[model samples]
Target: MFLRLSPRHGSRLLTRIYSAVAARRCPSCSAPLPTALPTCPSCSHIEPLPSTLSYHDIFGLPSVPNPFCVNTQTLKARFLQAQKICHPDAWSGKGKKEHDIAAAQSALLNKAYQTLLSPLQRANYILAQQGLSESETDRLGDTELIMEVMEAREELEEATSGEAVELARQRNRDRINRTQKILEKLIGERRWDDAKKAAVELKYWETIENAVKDLE
Candidate 1:
């Protein structure tokens, strides 16, 4: 029979296992890297960020935890710390080659931070890891839900007053929050199919939010 692991224990075990893999040699000086992170703390060398590293790994977080559970304050601090070391401007005088590496490293970090910071994007990323990309998410089958969103969009088009826009925003926000909770449960349970559906629902809500604009 296969062994069963408690979620907490499993997370710790996975973190340790991944951390070992994450620590790599700095290609320049052969120094051990804390992660595949672009900067080498030992030699002040900057390397290209590896695509194989997960966004969570870049920030030294356990990859198995709910992606949305990351601490905002902690993530921000880690991002700032990484940026200070590998931002393109930091390597401007080093050499064109090093500066190019730093530029790519900085771009990757920004993408990772932005992905981890947004709940919808985080869900999409996690799902993508399971081979269920957002683009591949099956079309949502909830007819009534589709109708509700369509109605909301139509209402938004005619919305003239600040109060009306604020109300619409609140409704969209609530819908997004509920979908997030559903995603958390489905993902934590490893129900990839259902989690993908929830993520698709979230994407619709986010798109609607983007259409909301300042009242003229």
Candidate 2:
């Protein structure tokens, strides 16, 4: 278990789960790294960023008990701040190596921000961390769920008017919102199986939502 809380008592007890995470440091200045972000806040050194860092870790967000609940304001603020330091524009006229590293960092940071900002992407990311591949997320086996998505698609295709499209669009939006809530709870409880299924459900809903946009 990554983390388990005590039920009978308020106190917590951790079992034998040894983790030895190395301290991140700036090579040039040897300053303690505050976040897993690509650049050092103290010395403006661009360290090699680890791909293993969770999206939460990149932004310095809490990654325990309830990583699904994100404060968007906090995430946005941090993302913009990080981008200012590492954006390729800021690195121009510097050495090619510095510019290249900054460009890479900027790209990775942008991808991380978009993934966490979207509900479906965030849920799928958690499942990926728990041993599911990005491709496997769409291979849903729930017959009922498949049928529901098919029917929704058919209804949208059959929509002949803007009003009809809006109606179908609203229906899909509602479904997506509901699935987001389910994902939040299942992920918080570490119910990986249920969470994976819900992530797939959300994926279908998101596809429909996009299709709705095309219709409009």
Candidate 3:
């Protein structure tokens, strides 16, 4: 069964887990590290992996919906806190070990922000997390729906001749809304099988959106 986590609780758990893993000693020499350091400066020994990291820790979030459901204000505060602690500038004039750790952590945090902020990417990330990737069977089943989107896309693609361009653009926008509604319904119903089908059709709608932009 898939376990669900509230964004607030999940973020706190991830932060605590990462902070604990970040607090460690050099494995080889048994020397303690500074509280701020994620790795030992002297031995260059790596620590065990943390249980959780940011959403971008692995390209995006797992199958959890509401990827941006985390309290925006709280997330902003936590991001600033992370920057203060893990920003590479803090390690200036420090040894390579500290610098590298700071840089790596900073990069991960930035990635998390980017992935969580984007809706489409977040959806793809969630699906991947569920071990439910885009598949051929999903595509085939949704072909009729996809064909509708594909036809619209082709119309937009071929609209360069006249005022048809404007008509195509408006149609594309309308489809975008309709496609979103379908996907939302499928996900809300936890119909993964159908969700995948909707996802495939949405991809075609997205393609039409992109293609129509060229007409403008």
Candidate 4:
């Protein structure tokens, strides 16, 4: 079991035994798996593992927060350090057991890094904590705003000069920044349903992010 908790007795147990059940390596060369799996660095073999594994356990964090905010850069650094240790390069000339361990660790690291990175992604993480999965596509009540974002993307994509795209980019950036403030306030109030409602709108802001990239 990944986690076993008993709050009344204050008893708990967590296991880091992913290496045992998962075959994380190149079948031919026995090369350890990399974070971006299906492509082994050592032997260039494709080996993809199932996603059922927990990202939290992959990085060795308490399943829930306690004096640890999700945005803590220190925790992020620790995660990166864990990934470094598990990188296949560290297992040079190691035995099969060692190689497998390294591969499992690397895969966990990649998944963990991806989980903790973005605010929307973080919202989904919080949703998972609540036994909910945030919708992959957000629905907004403001169809006009949605259409606006769509048009902006098309315009930005076709813009001939950086200045033209920059104008659209800045406008969308301001909108996203404003929406982010709303998101933070809702989360602070623990108004998740409202936060999720806003998140659907915020998904449109992601289009703005894409617009920014197009400008660049």
Measured against the true structure, the TM-scores of the candidates, in listed sequence, are 0.79, 0.79, 0.59, 0.60
Clashing pairs in 3: none
lDDT values of the candidates?
A: 0.79, 0.77, 0.59, 0.60
Error of 2 at 40 (Å): 4.9
Backbone collisions counted per model = 0, 0, 0, 0
Model 3, 1-216: lDDT tens digits are: 976889867876776555554354545776765532344556654333343544633222233454423344554565665566566786666778767866887777676665555444545555665577865564535556657766876786677666898788778778766766766666666666666666666666677777767655
| RMSD after Cα superposition, model 1 | 5.5
Candidate 1 vs candidate 2: which has greater lDDT?
1
> Number of the top candidate by lDDT?
1
Per-residue lDDT, model 2, residue 31, is 80
Which of the predicted structures, 2 or 4, would earn the higher lDDT when compared with the native? 2
TM-score for model 4? 0.60
Q: For candidate 1, write residues 1-216 as lDDT tens digits.
A: 977999766775665554455455666787876554747867778756544567888888656656656776778888888888788888888889988998887888899999988998898899898899878545668999899889878888878888888898889889988998998889888899989889988988888888885443
Candidate 2 pairs with clashing backbones: none
Global Cα RMSD, each model: 5.5, 6.7, 8.1, 8.7
Error of 4 at 129 (Å): 2.8
User: Worst 10-residue stretch by lDDT in candidate 1?
Assistant: 15-24
Q: In candidate 1, which residue pairs clash?
A: none
| 10 residues in a row with least lDDT, candidate 2 | 11-20
